[model samples]
Target: MRLLTVSALLLLLLGPGLALQIQCYQCEEMTHDCATPEFIVNCTVNVQDMCQKEVLVKDDGIHYRKSCASSGACLIASSGYQQFCTGKLNSVCITCCNTPLCNGPRQKKRPPASGAAAPNAPRVGLLPLPLLPLLLLSSTLC
Candidate 1:
């Protein structure tokens, strides 16, 4: 219950969604050396389950399985019960930083002007005392 309360408070205060994950995709097909006739490859940064794991993937003749890596260590792959490596397959991870990827320029958002405030900024003593109490109660209950 405490954890849920804290998570709820964080979601409300932080606005929404997880922060941007600055992933520099370095995978097999992500490299110049790797080109497979059998499969396609893609990668994404997932920040769920209290984990920051990198998902390395390989597609066999039939399907793809992510050989999940947690931070730096390799964990047992999801495609258990199958020995699915091939001579054509290339393993990709952070170590393969030389792997070529098309990255665009980073965008920076400038803050609003310092002297000006939002149009919706609360005016001093705008609401009467009774209304103020009601607003507080509503926010807490909400």
Candidate 2:
């Protein structure tokens, strides 16, 4: 298939040791406010290429966590709200990306009752035009 051919070519072009890796700030704690992390370290993601920054909300308060995620994770963070546990539980936000070390700083804030993300929610732009084809080829191989 043409897809297979392109994938093979791209794989060969990438050479060895070019596996996708996502670096993220891995931490979790329950607090009214998440402390601004001073330094970010690499998160070990064996099979997943995506990174995630999530804020889980419950009756107690905010719980912040960040780490790697599977590829099925959205290319961008969703501003929509998802509630569970009889509406007592909520996810303030779940931001995802494929770039290495893309999960940047996170600060805790109460989830809006209206389910809208904060005005400053992170947004990841699409790949450049020239690079898009290469990424597509690489994905086919994988």
Candidate 3:
């Protein structure tokens, strides 16, 4: 009974820190839409906490690379190449986002030309919804 009580207490304390792993659209291609549901993948838990999107404007056509990335690496890459993000010939733009499936597509409205950062999309809540009931039941049984 004491062990069960301790386990339940631990669950209540630590469970909120756990979250569903983020999912992102993952693909590399210029010929097809990589943002489609077919390309979605669950990012590596704990290691990859963000989605990265790279758009390259080439002579032939635009190319896209999408994949899971660590937050530090993604942020550095995106900011380092910010000046080259112009949508012109041979331009390269990289962006990082934390929200699920945020790298999927561009919104219809464009960001301002002044280069100010756009507000981040809302993140998934820290505690997953399904865990609440489990925590409650564990508390009662203990």
Candidate 4:
């Protein structure tokens, strides 16, 4: 039947389209582990100004990325981080950062002590090295 043929064609063309979705390289937010990351459902990642911070808690972690379309039911890639989205938005860009996000007071990088500084930085106080505890105990005795 002509109707049947058209229906088959439509199904063939549109059925798989529904399975595609956008995937993030490091969606660490959805899944607790990067090995098995989770996705932000029914949402987009705003990569424009969120990549820097691993978890974009401000907007539920979902960005407005457009180029990332998957062949599944709208899924997001995770990398063990956390995120949140306040409303529905698409086409996002995230400003990724190798270090943790700037959450609080920043630790100033100390300038190398002129000549007084030792070649190798010593394991100063309360380190987790093998003999740190023993050294601490010895110092406490003094």
Candidate 5:
């Protein structure tokens, strides 16, 4: 019991001095659509800080941000921007971490169908090219 109390007291005394050193990626890379990150840089974080990975999707393009931020900022980053960015943004994802160099790029999540169309998205038209030629030939024969 005495040892437990002593240990707890020591922890209380030393806990305030113990701070974590975090490493994260720092860069702002933009893409027409959400794609793999193309650039990465090393950044050091402050004590009790967190690494932030954010995705900002707009009608024009998608942007990826990785940097160091405080825990409080991480919690309110999204909510704080909701008012002004509500309808402008298609999708937004902000992830926070504390480990060293843990802010590696991740696959960006695309917005719903209301967002930009995919590169290879199938075209929708009156008829298929082959069938259109066949129909034209059949009409000419008739």
Candidate 6:
């Protein structure tokens, strides 16, 4: 009973803080790497809890925009422009994610196995929040 109470108290205090705090790469540039250490920034807590990345293909070169964003706005923009995300001329792709440093470049997907089709949608990596307090409590208790 005592351990349960302590765990609940820790969760109550840390849950929102952990959920709201996020770090992401922030930059706008063309033909340059933006995922360097200097470009990383902490997103505005509670207000901007997601990382957003925009890729625009233009005549000269590709443009990249990485920054913090609110979940609703980022998701709406991503869904609305999904059709125009084709990797052809004038292609514009926007993706959002919830985990730390998620605005960085995407990792190459592994080929499907046994003729399975690959997924089309971008994967949003989410950090498990509820287990955080439990992990902390366990670490301290042990």
What local lDDT score does residue 85 receive in model 3, on the 0 to 100 scale? 94
TM-score of 5: 0.47
Q: What is the lDDT of residue 139 in candidate 5?
A: 58
Question: Candidate 3 residues 90-114, lDDT tens each?
Answer: 8999999999999988779966777
Candidate 4 per-residue lDDT, tens place, 1-142, comes to 6555655665566554433233333433442323222332222433222222232323444322222222231233332222323233432223332222221123598887786657686856654343444455455555
True-vs-predicted CA distance for residue 141, candidate 5, Å: 99
Indicate the residue-level lDDT of 18 in model 3. Answer: 73
Better of 4 and 6 by TM-score: 6
Question: Candidate 1 lDDT, tens digit per residue, 74-117?
Answer: 22332331343332344332221211221211237678897877
Per-model lDDT: 0.35, 0.61, 0.85, 0.35, 0.62, 0.85
Deviating ranges (above 4 Å) for candidate 4: 1-79, 82-103, 124-142
> Which residue segments of model 6 deviate by more than 4 Å?
1-19, 108-142
Name the lDDT value of residue 128 in candidate 1.
Answer: 42
Residue 38 lDDT in model 3? Answer: 86
| Model 2 lDDT per residue over 34-123, tens place | 334643555554566777766777778767776676766543344343333132466467778777666655437776778776779997
Question: With candidate 3 superimposed using the best TM-score fit, by how many Å does residue 113's alpha carbon deviate from the native?
Answer: 28
Candidate 6 lDDT over residue span 1-142, tens digit each: 7777788887787667664589999998646659889999988889998999999888888889999999999999999989999988899999999999988877789767886655785767655767765876777876
Q: Higher TM-score: candidate 4 or 5?
A: 5
Candidate 5 stretches with Cα past 4 Å from truth are 29-48, 81-90, 107-142
lDDT at position 51, candidate 5? 79
TM-score of each: 0.21, 0.44, 0.67, 0.19, 0.47, 0.67
Backbone clash total, candidate 5: 0
Q: What's each prediction's clash count?
A: 0, 0, 0, 43, 0, 0
Which pairs clash in the backbone of model 5?
none
